[model samples]
Target chain A: MKMIAAQALVKALEHEEVTTVFGYPGAANAPIYDALSKSTIKHILTRHEQGAAHAASGYARVTRKVGVCMATSGPGATNLITGIATAYMDSIPLIAITGQVSSEMIGRDVFQEVDITGATAPFCKHNYLIKSAKDIPKVIREAFHIASTGRPGPVLIDVPIDLQLEEIDFQYSKGPDIRGYKPTYKGHALQIKKIVEAIAESARPVICAGGGVITSNATAELTELVEGLGIPVATTLMGIGAIPVPHPLCLGMLGSHGVRAANLAVAKSDLLIVIGARAGDRATGQTDKFARQAKIVHIDIDPAEIGKNLGTNIPVVGDAKIILQQLLNYVDEHYKEKHYKTQWISTITQWKNAKPTNNIKEDGNNEQYVNPKYALSVLSEVTKGETIVVTEVGQNQIWAANYYQTVYPGGFLTSGGLGTMGYGLPAAIGAKVGSPEKTVIAIAGDGSFQMSMQELGTMKQWDIHIKIILFNNYRLGMVRELQKMKYQMNYFAVTLEGSPDFVKLASAYDIPGEKITNNSKVKEALDRALSYQGPYLLEFIVDPEESTL
Target chain B: MAKHTLSVLVENHAGVLSRVAGLFSRRGFNIDSLAVGVTEDPNVSRMTIVVDGDDYTVEQVTKQLNKLIDVIKIRQLNPSDSVARELALIKVTANSSTRPEIIQIVDIFRAKIVDVSKNTLTIEMTGVADKIAAFEEMLKQFGIKEMVRTGMIAIERGNQVIKIGSSEESE
Candidate 1:
């Protein structure tokens, strides 16, 4: 049947089983909005295009599907850049649609026209500029495929205005057929053999799993592999959900903010088997010194990542699930009752036992201000395992990473790669939208919260029941900490002298707000925020001297 | 580390070469050498990259190259029976100082002087990577002031394109 390009977009999205989209309508994208009105897809009108992209990110993270966001050309599309880059850095699957000028007016710099495809090329996984209506169906399908497939990331489709109005026969296709876009999911037999050989020969081996495992839904496979081999597992921040925190073999998160034992374990391991992680700088501090003692067996779907950061002695290029399955097969073939050396396990166990202990004095009578770590411990104990936690960059993010115990998969969301501030509030709103049944809380520092605090209106407008817990240290706490540690305490721009009262700021948005000066009020504020039916904010005047991480 | 041949198709535009070469240097992936030339597509140029890495790394580099917007396609050519060559132009002092010695060395290497002035002789030579490196080293002894080389480019000796999904045929 002949249909408009905009109609084809809706049809292709329907084929992808996308039920909802988040976006704001503009003149350039009016055709798309009009077509969406006729389709079954639900479009959530966002206060800002950035919010739309971030909300889509949250939705995608929860559903493990490509979250769709739309905007018009020019500023409408540019607004989504930050959110798109956020998803790109985090490896979240997102499909961003934008309207463009007519093909005839493209090079003439028509009103509301921007070269969005070119603008987003460096950040996007892939992008397409639709010149003809006939290509809309194929382009949309390819966008979804590229965004959600191996090494998932944001993909953009810039639809020209004329094409959107043009009619074409648009039968929705279910797959992509570009000759150059095949992604490998199965491990090569020889590479798998080499990995198995390396594992068998190593006396001390540890597995470093990343978010790809969760993206591939290979948690069970990873758990089985590690448990079967009796090897310890350390996860990147994005890899939090790959293994249950309760599992004895799981070594929480590994990085600068990682568990002390996990970091030390990586430092001492004889063999490091990295799966689905690029070994990003944050995860591997001082790259030259990272895992210096270990021979690395890097497994990933993207082959370029093998030697991009650190050289891999054995590289397996395939999907995490398929590679794990192959390794399991190899292990079964070379079955041995005692694969792990007992001494290695015992040594690691001893290190784990000596891990840092959290102690909070019950009296709380000290004249000095509360430690952020202690506050985090208290929050962790109160929030327990049921609440979803979102953190801003800097001290608050580090504190949450170190203290918050995420008992559930996909429970923790933060800007790990980009480390963007103001990510907490909008992302938390998205997370709440994605999982409305859960209690979502965002932990933000004074500086970071102010970056995207305008999103509080979004939460209010959407009636999202997310708790905003602002650690009001009256400064950019992370930068301050860095100054003290590295810059010899010469605080320059890190100080926030005349900050607005967060309680008043939260009230400006007509959201219920509170300020807690005493540690005794933390639990009560937390309880009130959690119990509040709508959005709520609690500003805690944390001591500036306290180290959050 | 094993040598691998990569064929990359990129947009024929300025600064693309710098960006592409810069990526290699930053990554520290030792490119033994590379060759580039215009392909059948007038707008697209092909680069044959010879690097030392395993199969997985080679495939990865190719994928990354393809990811570049300027780059259209990339394929790994088989090492066996592939012709690899490089071209180098050397400017040497050709006055009474070292004119005879430079000519003798250039003649021995079967090189040609593409440009000649009263005081300078510019010799152009094309050969494999080792030969180019050797020629440059030999010319350094004769007070060589400047040298330029087009990196190595290669193609299979037979009529074989670096077709996709030809894993069985590669070996």
Candidate 2:
């Protein structure tokens, strides 16, 4: 049976069980749109290609499925780069399909022609440029497999206009068997036993969980291991919500911006079992000083990451979920003798209790601006640590990460690696779409919120009921503080002086919004926004001189 | 710091070269020399990469190269157990007065004069990288006009081989 590549593409998506796609259309992908219209898949027309990409990322994170996004050639594909890079950095599984000019016109520099595959090669996990319609089904299958497996990241498929119009014999292929693309899922038994012995020998053992816990859905296994072993857990910025913050064993995030106690725990440990984290500079501070006293056991799916940043004494290269489960089993079976970490826990507890971690507390008497931390604490309190908090980078992100206190697995989403601004609003829309039962809130600083403010139209048009919490500091708060700390307070190009009244801007989209000026009204304002049935925006006036800590 | 040679087996495709080269440049790993050619298996390609790095850097380079989807396998070729060769073409400025001396030097190196004009002689030599460099250095006194080199290529001696599914011998 013969079918157009566009029709076969839609069929391929159906075979993969893709229920929704975030996209922006043009002449290049008009045939795909036409085919998509006849299928059961839901199409979300984002205001910009960037929004579509981010929204797909959000959807992927919440659904734990490969997010799909599409855009036309040139500028449309270029616009998806930041979001692609953002997904790549965080290891979100995504498939970005872009339309190119006709096959012959690709190299001729015709209208709307860009080498998107080459442009995204540095960032994307893999990419393909389709030359034949017959290869669509196999390529799509491979793209999905590659995007979702190993260290999940974005995969790009560039289809030319002529290929989409070409008729080919259609047959959906089986799962990919690329010889060179095998991902080791089962860990070595000897390495697992070694980790157990190291755990049993240490007086001060700490587990550093990274984004891999969430990516591999190993949160349950991790929580079990942490609880069973009575070992303290410190998470990277990307590792938030891997173990609930309320858990006594949880020491919160560990990094430059991480909690002081978590950092101390990692530094003082005799043995550190690092799972699924790269231990990047931000997380490790200075690599030599990071966990200097500890014998590190690094467990990760990617072999390259095991000893990339920090030296590893015992390296287990496999999926985190499997390895953690193996550790759990080994502990349950033969590890009868338990090492006491009472002094270690008490020491960490004392450090956590010490008030200097958050030295800049709300003075309570300030009437002009809201304490952003205090406001987020209220949001956490009112929501009962139940909301999916997607935060834009800057002061707002750090505040949310510290204060939100996510209780469930995968409850927090942010651009931890890339630290992309304007990520929250669109991501919140995607999360809400993916998980309709949960309340999703996008927390953004004033400067970051306006980066993708046009996404308000996407929410309004799709009726996505995501709450937007914009912290109005009237300046690029994070950069201003950076200048104050490092550049001798020479503030230039950091102020949002010409920014619009965000509340009024939301009103123009007919979304109800409120503006609060002080900490006293934070809970009431958040409660109001969360209680509203439709989309809502709540703006809080934060102090211009507010410190992140 | 130290020089190491890695023989990588990759799927034969247009993008595989870029993917391997891009990984090196992106990761800040410096490649001193690289040579790629089709293997006995038509679908497989072999790449010999000579890099300057310490043990840590070599480990990282091998691991990073293995990460690319096109790369099938990698083996760090030990100098004692492997045979390495490089081919270089030297275009030396040759006049009637200098021709005999250059030819004698070429004869000693067992190099062939592949192309010759009245003004220059292009000598093709196949040997170890150091030997080729030494030959080039000897000819530099004669005012060589131009040169090209196919970096380096190596294979295991004594029946040991580098091929797909032969990853146990890799670093």
Candidate 3:
């Protein structure tokens, strides 16, 4: 059958099971928009191109699939750069399609002509400029495949206006046939055996989980391994939901904002088994001092990630599930009657017991405003494991990371690498869409939420059920905290003055909102917001003096 | 530490080179040299990078590279049997005082002067690592001021093509 390149793009996305796309219409990409209108795919018209890209990122992060975004050439395409880079940095899967000037005018510096392919080359996993209509289907399919597989990132396909307008015979193939894009999934047997050997020989071992564990859906296998070996498991911020928070062997989060016990365990362990984690700087805290006492064993699907940071005595390159399963089998065969160190477990238990308490001091006369940390603790207690919590960047993110208890995999979503503000609401909308059965909550700081407060319209438009808990300290709380710690508390531009009433703003978007100042009213307000939520916002005027971590 | 070859697939765009190169520079990863070009897919560009570090450090560098938004795929190529090539255009002073000596040096190195003006001559050379280093070192004496290198482009020896099909089939 004969088809146009723009039509092929839509067909390719359908094959990839992409149902919805976020984008803005433009002159350069009107042909694509025209083609899309005839297809079954739903196109969400975003107010801005940046919103479209970020919305796509949110969708991809929640669905664990390739999120699609579209924009026009020149300025429209350039606007998607930040969102594309955000997804790139965090390893989120996204496919961005941009409209380009005609092939004839590509290098002539004609009107609306920018070398978009060259502009986006470094930030995307792979990108293509469709010079021919015949290349459209293949390029689109490959772009999705490359973006969603292996380490998973954003890919771009720039379709020229002429190509989009040109018609060609289109055939949707079963799969791609590129010769250079090989990615290994199965674990190497030798590497698995070596990892088993390391596990068996170690006296004190701890399993460190990262975001990749969740990405690969290896949580169950990881849980089985940890339980069987009595290994204490600690997670990075991105790795929060890899193991159940209530599990006996779980050490919660590790790093600067991680639990004290978890950090202590990581520091003192004799052997560290890192699974699907790159051991990023935030998680390692002074690299030279991190795990100074431990021998590391790193397992990751991306071979490049093995031993990238801390030295790994055993490097197993493959998917986490495959590697863990192999290790489990190897251990079962070789160490059936192996002895575990009872003394080491007792020592860890002792360390756990010695950890400092998080009890909030309640002096009846000392009430000024709500402490953000205390408020988060309260939210944690009330929400427990029922709600999926999304956090904006900065102090609120740190507070959520340190205090929020996620009980299952895929429960917590945040902007980790780029730490983009205003990510909470839109991402929460996407998370809710992905897991419609769950109650989604967005915990955002006043400064951060305002950055993306425009997305409240998206939530309202989609009728998404999200409980937004805005910690309104009227400042960039995290920066202020940093200044307090290192900059002698001389506040700079971090403070906010006469900020818009978030409650009024939410009302303007046709969403219900409430303002809470007293600590005592937080639970009541949260309950009210959670109970009748199409998309509800609760602004908590938090104490500026409170530290998030 | 030994140097290793890393092949990275990235979106073909501007500033991506700087971002990737900047990362290595900032992280203290000694990149021996690097090259980037459009792949079979016009949207994708391949980067051939040579960096010096231990296995762990190299792994770390690749992981960081993977974290980059534009870097879609990265693979560590085997050092043996990989055809590595680099192109350099060096403009040196070629006044009557130094023209003949420079030409003789270029002839000895089998380098071609692609461009020439009154007082300057641009020599283009391509070779393996040692020869390029020697050629550059020799030209330094002729008051070489400007040099542009096409980093390094490489492919594995044999008829095998590192295409999309191989990558997908392996997965």
Span of ten consecutive residues with least summed lDDT in model 3 chain A: A356-365
In candidate 3, stretches whose alpha carbon ends up further than 4 angstroms from where it belongs are A108-114, A331-337, A340-342, A353-367, B1-171
Top-down TM-score ranking: 2, 3, 1
- List lDDT for all candidates, in order: 0.80, 0.90, 0.80
What lDDT score goes with residue A449 in model 3?
A: 83
**Candidate 2, residues A307-420: lDDT per residue as tens digits?**
898989999999999999888887763453365467777888888888432323556778898988888777777887889999999999999988888987779999999999
Reference contacts preserved by each model: 0.19, 0.69, 0.15
Per-model TM-score on C-alpha atoms: 0.84, 0.98, 0.84
Chain A TM-scores of all predicted models:
0.94, 0.98, 0.95
Better of 2 and 3 by DockQ: 2
Of 1 and 3, the candidate ranking higher by DockQ: 3
Q: Candidate 3 docking: what grade?
A: incorrect
True lDDT of residue A159, candidate 1: 89
Which TM-score values does chain B get in all models? 0.74, 0.95, 0.81
Query: What C-alpha lDDT, on a 0 to 100 scale, does residue A125 get in candidate 3?
Result: 75
Candidate 2 Cα deviation (angstroms), residue A98:
0.4
